[model samples]
Target: MTLEPDLRDDLLAAVPSLRAFAISLSGHVDRADDLVQDTLLRALSNLHRFERGTNLNAWLFTILRNLFHSQYRKRRREVEDPDGSYASRLTVQPEQGARLDFEDFRTALSTLPHDQREALLLIGASGFSYEEAAVICGCAVGTIKSRVNRARSRLSSILKVDATEAIGSDPVIRAALHTAR
Candidate 1:
């Protein structure tokens, strides 16, 4: 059976209040209109489940609230990447590439002179300042700086990497390259 004439009129009269409630809940006119339309559709479809003597307005409001909450829960897991920048960053580069890059870096580092390697390691890997490295190496701070610079230049040339280019995902390797640049 269809909705009674009086109930239909009641539903028609409830539209303004429903729209206002929807707007207040959603804070967007387009979304509020959609919520009200969905609520009316659900109410009409499920009229048999709605008791006749009870409140109809409350039932519609409950439906609208439940719809909003369901939408919210579903949206919580979604990322709004309209421009695809976030999606672009989600891809993992091949593990083999990183491994090969790391091996190349190690080989280049091993070819550096002993003093230059010590200076680069003390400054880049060990996080020591030039003065601190000089004290440890029993040399002048300028000498330590020169050795690090020479070592970085030699490694970059040996690895065939541009000074500005980043190599691998390893933090230590990245830090060394970044300082070199």
Candidate 2:
């Protein structure tokens, strides 16, 4: 059975959760949106597979989650967080806000080496586990973890990130920096 007009509307309402789950799986916002759209389309096509009386939201989530897993298993390396900070560390250190220049931060990120960029994006920007990142990168998990750390060190140096001044001027960094402080 195809998703009827009413079912389609119900499907649409779950898009937000789908997108969020997609991002958690894929790391890139655009990619997440794309995944969500793909999931909806897939659901529409396979609506007959959905068991009536089962949870519609759960069914949709299963579709999206399964799709993500399929993509991940096929090629984990497809959308790895290239920057090492794992999305978790991208926050700016609060107290250092006064010293930040958005331009400088952007420029500095651009100046980072490719490997460094990859490391930061995967670990810092995406928030992937090292094991997951490594699987995605087709490398040892340790290598993935190391790349993240090394990239952080490189950024700290390039940005002249003072332990005292805060490692990042961004709130993410600020929260991390608070512990450091």
Candidate 3:
């Protein structure tokens, strides 16, 4: 069903705040603009889920936050090596050792069971607390902790590196491994 005129107006009025929040979360104007657009589209599509007389702003913000987190999780696994420069940098065996190590870590991460991987990503890469991860994953806090621990151990074994040894210079990779403990 189409939104009523007043509801449509309210949604349009929320755009500025949504864009600002997106910018603060993304730290890039272009990405923030895209995020705001996506948020509005999602809100429009899900208007039936919105309750009348409730805080429309809160609902929109929640949608934006969820979209950001979902995108963040997907983006963390991607390498932005548009040209050959990044791969060439890794060719220097000594100076760019971390680059190679990051590749290996990424491969090992993909081999993890979905549950363990999800827990690790939420807690480590996304910087969510155990309680928050538990809520997101619909599991007990202890279960999330267990999954993270198991995932870390499995990754360490697969990469044949000491659990405490620093693997890659990539901040997200380092955060995932370091915070898994």
Candidate 4:
């Protein structure tokens, strides 16, 4: 029992709407699109179970939401950013408009221990609430906070990137560092 041709067309058309909703809920566009695709497939396969008289849009949204929840549960322990775009913000325009700090920060981040680094990335960089970070990392809120603090300390100490040095790839951090210096 698959969705009819008309229903399939409708599902394809609703991808954008489904994606937007998924992004809002999950805060990651790549995950949102993947969720939408999965929802469409599930809707098509389970079309027979759908009550024809009900709203199809609502049904699809529900399917996508359910899938998102399932993924959250399955990956609670995994540091999975489906979109992989979440990081420190602020536009970077170097002397030649090069994006250098990303590679630098990536190298800096790679050197930290897993726990400390994950905590800082989730809280300081990705803007995840301590509770959300804890849920994502399978830890207590206090533990998450402690990890974040420790991670920042360790990175600052290791990189010697001088939190006070006007040396970020972005204006915001550079300005702050300049002011601090």
Clashes of 4: 0
Q: What lDDT would each prediction earn against the true structure?
A: 0.86, 0.71, 0.88, 0.73
Where does the lowest 10-residue lDDT sum fall in candidate 4? 172-181
List, residue by residue over 80-137, the lDDT tens digit for candidate 4: 4556655344354555432565455567778878997887777766768889999999
Model 3, position 30: C-alpha lDDT score: 96
Error of 2 at 47 (Å): 0.6
Global fold similarity of model 4 (TM-score)? 0.41
Cα lDDT tens digits for candidate 1, 1-181: 5767999999999999999999998899998999899999988888889998899999988998998888778888999999999998897768997798888888888889999999988998889989999999999999998999898888878877775355877766665655533
Candidate 1 steric clashes = 0
lDDT of 3 by residue, 5-31 (tens): 999899999999999999999999999
Poorly placed runs, candidate 4 (over 4 Å): 1-3, 80-181
Q: Which residue pairs does candidate 4 place in steric collision? A: none
lDDT of 1 at 33: 98
Name the TM-score of candidate 2.
0.40
lDDT of 4: 0.73
Which residue runs does candidate 3 get wrong by more than 4 Å?
A: 84-181
Give the runs in model 1 whose Cα sits over 4 Å from its true position.
1-89, 179-181
